[model samples]
Target: MGKNTQDGTPGSWFKITIPCGGKYDKTWLVNSIQNHCSVPFTPVDFHYVKNQARFFVQDAGIASALKDVSYKICDEENQKISIFVNPSNVPYSVRYKLEPEEMEQLKLTMNKRYDVFQQALDLQRLRFDPDLVDHDIDIILNRRNCMAATLQIIEENFRELLSLNLSNNKLYGLDGLSDIIQMVPTVKILNLSNNELNLVWELNKIKGLNLEELWLEGNPLCDTFPDQSTYISAIKDCFPKLLRLDGQELSPPVTVDIDTPYLIKPCKESYKGSETLKSLVLQFLQEYYLTYDSGDRQGLLGAYHHEACFSLTIPFNPEDLAPSSLCEYSKESRNMKKLKDPYLWVQLLKHTKRDIVCALGVLPKTQHDLSSFVVDMWFQTEMMLCFSVNGVFKEVEGRSQGSVRAFTRTFIVTPASNSSICIVNDELFVRDATPSETQNAFSIQVPTPISSSMSILSQEQQEMVQSFSTQSGMKLEWSQKCLQDNEWNYTRAGQVFTMLKNEGKIPEEAFKQIP
Candidate 1:
């Protein structure tokens, strides 16, 4: 009994059950529960949470005032059963959970109500109306400037109502809408289809409000700016839960109209490089983003050959089936547009023993003795020498020997002829733009003893590190995997800065060591 332990195991259950029905008035917090954790649920149970709604069908008066509010309920097979048909008979205790989307839709709908409320107030329509009625409203229907007063009074009676009807009117901002959205535990269904307002900011904060639909159409200033598409895209990218957009059609993607070189706008010095290639790239992106972004493929690499010499690389087991790859780029190198019709160049030369292709995992994850091998890349018809850019070796655990690693990159390779490489699939259209015309090899300072300590990045090394974002994740991705334990030295800092600056994402501050 000196060192004893208790046995631990999962307990058995007699039965497993979940509800399944499709009714909006079910008053079940389905999405809230689902979003919180969905793996444990059966689909049938989730459906029941959404469809079997519990809403008021009738109401009753307390002080003989003749108040009546009716509620309805549906069963598993979609049959409507009345709840509060007779105002006096109330259920013992009803179960209901407010959804987040419903709250959002309610929030948007309140904006419409506020505007309508303002209009009715301005018009001075105080009595129950026959003509000015836009939709069903309980207390403040067709009243002149009575929204605030009506809401004040209505808040005294019913509590669950989160949305109001104030469609089609003039309101400066959707104020107090946040209170309704935040305070109301249960509210869904908002309709803000018509109004004269701009800049709705506060409604975005309702963390888990079930907001499925949003109607912000019929606003004049919504499209006042030409760059609205960029703005919208940026916002939607941030708010992933936004389900629907019931506004005026979002602006279409735009292409740079560079024909009016005479009508140039102000910009920084970065545009001095090949603007034609940039424009082409922008056009390609505008045309292809939807089809491109849907899958796990890497993103677009623009002018990589002309500007960065960053060769794309793939890691594979060294079973004699993978192509050697490396990158060539430089952070210190100034951005210069080189080629006019920039395109990827892949040679279909026959593979040879000397054919050089960069490989990964051959280098250990830990830093090791660095070495260089001038691969006589064997290709069809001729041989070309391929050099590893900033090559380094690493010693990994559980592995027998150390591995080699260097970025696949852009460099001056002396090809045998203009016909030395041909596109196996797309050679017919590739013009014979020799290296002198189309290529931008890495900028190497000549005749100087190699500053092994200076940590100067070749154009290829810079490009490989810079282009790492699209594939690996971000600047810190591959580095995090590779540099788990090592401390950053001055050379490492220099190399890190060179990679970041070339990427054009982080500023020069990234080059400095962390304090």
Candidate 2:
């Protein structure tokens, strides 16, 4: 009864119903119904007086095909026969009959090699029957020659499944797995161990899943790592919020900084600066931008240290043409390749002041809006201060009509002998503004100016707040709040921070600073 047809297509049983009360030709109805079905089937025995007809559908997922056709039994009532197939209530000969398109989709998904799905279908049927007690439908180690299509079938039908054990199934890769991950987000525990996966990068397709535990032991990918510690890095990178991997319980990082002062609604341009470092960076940027815009080669001669390196990368938009001077720039331009060039390396290694001057002079004149600036500064080492400046610079005196380009410049400032700081390493990236960004270029809504004295703090007190914020890993606004809350006493603020940190009440967002 389970044998395939001449074309190697599988068969399922379905019951066809029609009205017998009216003058209907039973022979014609059966012949027409069989021809109307999308997949060919053989009708089982049935009398003309008896309206019930059964068929062995030779093709999968054709139960819904019978519903698409219409046969008028009589004009008085306009009777329409609708075919309904229930998988659980099939005749004694047919063990499993797919219900409709939805259930057929699940039944058709099982790999045909092992026929383990025949067992899975029975298990699924029992789960849906109200008379049966609830049980787990864990599809483990069936070795059904599984593939991405198999997972897709399971995702459509078994979304409520919590644990799935597909280990020892000879699964080579997880292509098209994102569909399952998206469909079955409720899957918390998954075991895919002892498979042939060669890289963990395949797991990156799965995003926004609440996966608590994942198993990939005995895979070729695991063998590539020297130890569990090395492999865990890949796992953590792909699954940022995962709690467990390969049966090992992982501890999440303490992202909340307890010692950091808290600020509220801080200004974008505000810097959590140290007294000497912040002033030096701000002053350097102020003078640098002015000289950059002046288009004078001599003005930029003193900004770089003797051993400094400078490189600019332009991420051009496909729709926007590169300037005439920067003709080689493209949408895919990156400094990584340019830095490796021996010719460019020689110029940067020599740190020729004239070369730096000429490089800056050849570019179109730019007017950097300091008010739109967003600054982030941190000390990489005791002797080195690193900072990144992000803002929009308008290209003026060009063929284009003052197109705005968003720019980011990262600088490693080391203290010069004369108490001033010069950039030791300067990396710059410039890109055309997106449509939304171009529209919102000047539409930034700043915080309403506060009348509180916190806005009117002395330069020294303001620097103190910045210092506190930097040292404590807190936001500038939250640091202001702490200073205002503790009457500008660093000692009292320290105590308050300790209390909050001990109680695990510090907000995680305070530690995040946009670059």
Candidate 3:
């Protein structure tokens, strides 16, 4: 009974009917589709009726594919139930549109539900309302059409609406709930208890609502979590401002108020030592990051002491909004506060240069934004150097490709043979970059190199070539050639040098100092 277009393609919407006997829930249907269907598809919206389910896909090809494999899916009794993939005869807008008389009746019903003094609308058990039942009208909040119409009426009449209770409404999906955040912006207390909502991700539909109280008790999603603490944690992830949940008063959220007035001086990037020591630290960082960002991490074996120590740490809260993906490094994280086992503490630490380099090889390829780097020297002595560099970097390849992350790297180094410094201890902490950081990342322009006469260059340009040589660990001749190739632009020259170095195109003598 499925309808086809003039070209014999199936319609975008299809309904599947099965005999009402066994408990065929939404989770079962989703699993069956994922397991049996050969073609991969994501439904835009799904609705469940008493003995039928409707699926709205993006195109007709997916509809045809679903129809072809519909019979392959079996029920709890292992029997292939008959299915009718028919195009919804009525267009969605026409189906949900209310008649003039019906609109007036709905308005009247909503007026009865609204409490003007309390500024609350109690729409629980709306389908069973006596007035609606008398008028033979059924308003199911789970259906997108009904919810949209209800919110439209509330927006027009109740501009000051503060609280909304939508409990026991057989609601499984909140497709139209985001409108409340805009239409009823003042509404802070929401009650969605005793609903059929299952997946925790469904809460993402209304994630930005500034609600102080939320009630989601008696929902299927609550039981799916391992324990009550986990349930609360998951809910808090969605609603960080929630103070009360399901009749339980939660602890106040901890947050930093960056705008608070302060009398003390602000922290500025500083190196308390002399300029000579500062220059050494800068040169070291410039060389180390250049090698670290290169394709072959084995090249860094000489940068670390034979008995150096290295460890990585991540935020303890897995749901922290920062880093997009942490699974790649979470297992090896040596967070001292959370990791209490001494055995694990020793095992996670990389002790030798070989082990450290090997471990670094497994990390995703990265391109650091050197322009965004801020360094501060913590301690300086004849025996050792201690400092930290904070900056933004992009993952160029691997599971978290293209993700921008903020990182702080602390290094403890000591003088080694031949005037080189080697890392004695290193610690790296990574988190999600702030909005400003992500926006300004990699914004520095790189100019193309063009041949120009040295006589025409400015004093600043000549000085830049000398500085690039020291910072890049490249011979003066090679540094000058790189700058000239990049039109005498210092940033462009550095970027080109790094690219050539990573690709193994630069000669070894280019990085060595000329006699």
Candidate 4:
């Protein structure tokens, strides 16, 4: 069959014949042509008939060159089989295929349009290039495939392209421009004005560019917005670093220097009250938590005032780090901001020491980390003292057992009978522990118990006492006595040592190591 070229001239057709019974395909023939011929050309309308393949070429020079080359196709036998490329009787037409000559013309045209000093390639109105017009090759950027080919050429040759002007290209969509970032990621300025782009979303296809300047004033998408500011705002959302849009200067983007080091004040307890009040609060916390973490919740009955009120709050939206099961506390969480129902609020709150202790018993058994405590004295007066303790705790035995939690507990205490203070009001807030909090919780080494004739103590119990003594700088006898007084609990033992040490109540001999 005969086909005509773009200029109404008959294209040159050639038939390639290989050795009969030889194992060969069209790809083998194409590779052979590329290997043998010095000039580059694509086989248009390629098809096979038996053991022969016929193809058309628009460029007469490439067709003549192909005929002169001694093409050889190697078969399974490793024999050099001669392949013949002879002019065919049938004529063929070249539709969209660009021959070697036309490709060269396109490259020459691009070279003329490129500014080497500025590293900019101006491809606007590419279809009107006089050089490409003679070869009947119209470079249309609107065609995705055509645009891709053009970009491939630019990426191979002008790799350092920093600015590209693709204006007046009649581009309606940016699908062809999606890979522009990968091709030239450093490109800072882009001109896409005078195009047919009508939707703001089309720009999303090229969102990753670190473009500092963009030109889209003449596009239909610009007209869709109500005003210039709206257009600028919509475009700026796609490119945060854009400093100029359509020749207008935009405000420089506000960016944080993430690389700069920031000074984080060390975490420590804050006490705004007098030293006497501070010591009192510390002692009270040490005693209260020791009993609270014990097996018996009823032991805390005297710690609370007769009419003490207790309530618990948790975050409304828990994070992924939260324990998988929060059923233990979620049902009782009385966050006043989230739980607006006044009746439920009154029902969840515990009034009086007995009610508070019962409510605490229903919750999980816990082991509080004394070292993680960060106490803050909020207010103090002759009548009452208010303070808050933030710390981490582990659920020792429950449905959420082994999971760590961070909590903040606030207390309002007043002097009770016998010169003792009791909690008049208590509020507890719980949340998932942060990564650092979980790591730092209970990290301190407990003192190790000294070898003695405490035959009843288990090996684990001895180790706990020894660790506590080592950590508290107390002799083994005093450390064991302290741990025994606190039910052999390391956390409670350490807390008692700290309170006694701060109050000057510990004897000087207690700090001495065992012989």
Candidate 5:
């Protein structure tokens, strides 16, 4: 029924169990590989033992240290799908040509897997034979057409897979889909727009996607995509801000609407926030969010200074506002058009409290329009959405997709603590896609609605603040300080800020001045 792989190692020797109990053994694994292997699948005679599940595979430099491999089943976009070989080590090669017969076998295998995955996805409506997928599968050929009858089997079985693909297939109905999509972290691309999908949650797991694109034009989500802007928001959690939506490069002036309602009239006039000291607030927001000990720290400083007057420095609470100045969208600006911006301020408040620890009302997110950056923002204390081109912008250069060098940023409020707030800023300059390198970008958070003075402090702590402030010519508002310019030139002045904050020499109030 089957033989060993080219290396004479075990392949089909592995066990596969789908949700509906379609158990496949090593024979099946060998049959699929042997049948489909195209030009890339080099032939190397090897030895194997089916009973012991042991095999010695010869190497044509195809793969190495591969302990085992198999297909894994998973539910994606309301259909059961099959992912190819589960490997233990890094695959030796990615591009592999497929023989004509092998391609046919690949289709059959995927269709069978799709059927089982569907059964598990729609357990309530369709219940068919279970699956038989085992071991870790690496590749997932999701683009080919699967027979309609095979889809029925997936409704009964759920085989957790690494990569799931159903690019162009015959499938209908997209219910019971949230959990399956969430579980897949290695998914590359998914094309399910032609299928029927009504709920937004099915594709809400955008944060965890390792995906390059999602081809979703024909789904129900498109009609409601505009309304569910918050849920479908494209957050720059782990990818570039310049996204390719359906193969088209997303342009500037992007916006998203977070579902929270922030128009509640403040107990006091919004200007009450203006009472907060200016130098103190600016210093806190600027330094706290600026990247520390990084290349862009200086550039970040330049961003705040070169743009501060031109920039609308909206704080999280009333203190960030001017006590005397009336809060109004008085005039359009050189940098941004402000309509009482809320996102930037919230980030400032949250970081200040982290330094304070027990201070409540330190941060609160709000709903507002900041036309300057071309953004519509709504947020909770810890979350935000930039509802149009305003919040995102990009410039790129590349010869190809893999060689393309592009950059983008997504702004949000990380007001959970002082670190959260400041970290958001530092993260902006720091390379998100890589460990090294700096970026030119920034984001803001809203302030807390309710707050109180620090209760976690001892009298000694107050004394420390008093002593430090007295020592410095200026008030010791935040724990961080400029790295004497020299340090920033050599390293980063902001890096000194992080150190000082950890030492507790600076006061929590200083977070409002991070720049």
Candidate 6:
């Protein structure tokens, strides 16, 4: 057959021309293609001759991986065999043997509004227009006794399909849904109501879809839900950006902040700090993550002070979601949530190199995506700086699960010497990311500028300020003001302010502050 065959008959089952004289096991070679397929769908069956092997798929949808692509088949010896697919031959299921006239009649029955074609080329042949299908497409193939054949057609012709109405159809299971969605990732609104599907489990099949609206009210699956709320939550969990489901609009998720807004902002650029300070902070983090990601916790011992404290907390789903006892770090983890007292936490996680190394040993090895790093820096004092780095990290060892999680590490660094700094405190927080975020985790992000501004302090720091105020008999505001002016030195602030008062330069109104 010619390279560009448009007769609509699928060519022979996908054949891989292997190098001659190599006695290869056929069964093992063909089975690997299913796993190698981009979507990783199962094939109907596969067979092999002496020097060639072929995979038979039930429909074109299952073989979507083989279409318009060159697939490599590797043998036990690490030898590679390249398989090239025929570009023009349509590979629909054998059961869907409909002629051009019948497809046109089916399209007419569905209505002229929807663009239902037998194949993508049918648009050019029948309607004499191919470019018109570039934008959004609305297709209706409901109640026409459609099966894999119909879905294959949709997959073949899929353009920027915005809405698809397959309602009141005999469509049973959504075996080809993933392939069709993969073909047309632009589909945002889908109506599969009045169908025979009984389970909503297929929703998981379309994990990375950007579907905005989905209508499945009349399906048998609707009755399976215990309540409307349960159904909505399950659907939303699968597709986080889903705005409307079964005609009911879901309320957008709210981002609640327990900490005051001043402590955190939407982006690092919002954190007011100088460019020079930000650059230094970024440089430190870039190097820090390089060591940390390589599964060498002991290597980072120098990054921390001998008295440094490191605690980790993991939030489930949203930030407000109560954290699981053991976060994604490992199956069994003694996270910060389990520690009841500060002394116990410190004792368990001793502020020493050996202790930190032992503590991190239990966690899974990880590789952080440095490009996604968002650093926000604030100068607590001339010698001490506080910064938080939020980015995505993937597990590299142990479970080696293909999931990327968002992690936030806040470090309090003080100058150990004139040229270097050591971490006094390191607070780490982890959370499961939304599907959309994880999908685009590797996408390039504009580096957010970091800076410092006046903001709230931690409870420990607040208590220290209060202690200084009580001992000095100065108002809390004046005491904090003096301490900040003296670079957070408790003893120096008292002496400096006293000297200022003795010199008659101290302002009287500074001491008389509001509570």
State how far residue 95 of model 1 sits from its true place (Å).
Answer: 38
Clashes of 3: 5
Runs off by more than 4 Å, candidate 3? 1-90, 256-515
Per-candidate alpha-carbon RMSD to the true structure: 24.5, 22.4, 21.5, 25.5, 22.8, 19.3
* Per-candidate local distance difference test: 0.30, 0.54, 0.71, 0.70, 0.29, 0.55
* Candidate 3: tens digits of C-alpha lDDT, residues 348-447: 9998776677677777789887667899977766667788999998888886887889999998977665456678899999887889998777653333
* RMSD over all Cα atoms, model 3: 21.5
- Ordering by TM-score: 3, 4, 6, 2, 5, 1
lDDT tens readout by residue for model 1, 318-429: 4745432221111111222322232322332212111111111121233311112122222222232232222232223434222333333222222212212111110001
**Model 5: per-residue lDDT, tens digit, 289-363?**
332212112112212211111112322233445441212211211112333466543433323211221111111
Superior candidate under lDDT, 1 versus 4 = 4
How far in Å is the alpha carbon of 163 misplaced in model 1?
Answer: 6.1
* Ten-residue stretch with the least lDDT total in model 3: 255-264
- Kindly report which residue stretches of model 4 are placed more than 4 angstroms away from their true locations once superposed: 1-97, 256-515
Give the TM-score of each candidate.
Answer: 0.24, 0.31, 0.40, 0.36, 0.25, 0.34
Residue pairs that clash (backbone atoms under 3 angstroms), model 2: 260-472, 262-478, 262-479, 263-477, 263-478, 263-479, 264-477, 264-478
User: How many residue pairs clash in model 1?
Assistant: 67
Q: TM-score winner among the candidates?
A: 3
Per-residue C-alpha lDDT of model 2 across residues 70-90, encoded as one tens digit per residue: 452223355555554533233
For residue 483, give model 2's deviation from the true position in Å.
Answer: 23
Q: Weakest 10 consecutive residues, lDDT, candidate 1?
A: 422-431
Which portions of model 6 show Cα errors greater than 4 Å? 1-92, 115-158, 255-271, 274-515
Clashing pairs in 3: 322-432, 323-432, 449-485, 449-486, 449-487
Q: What's model 4's lDDT at 16?
A: 52
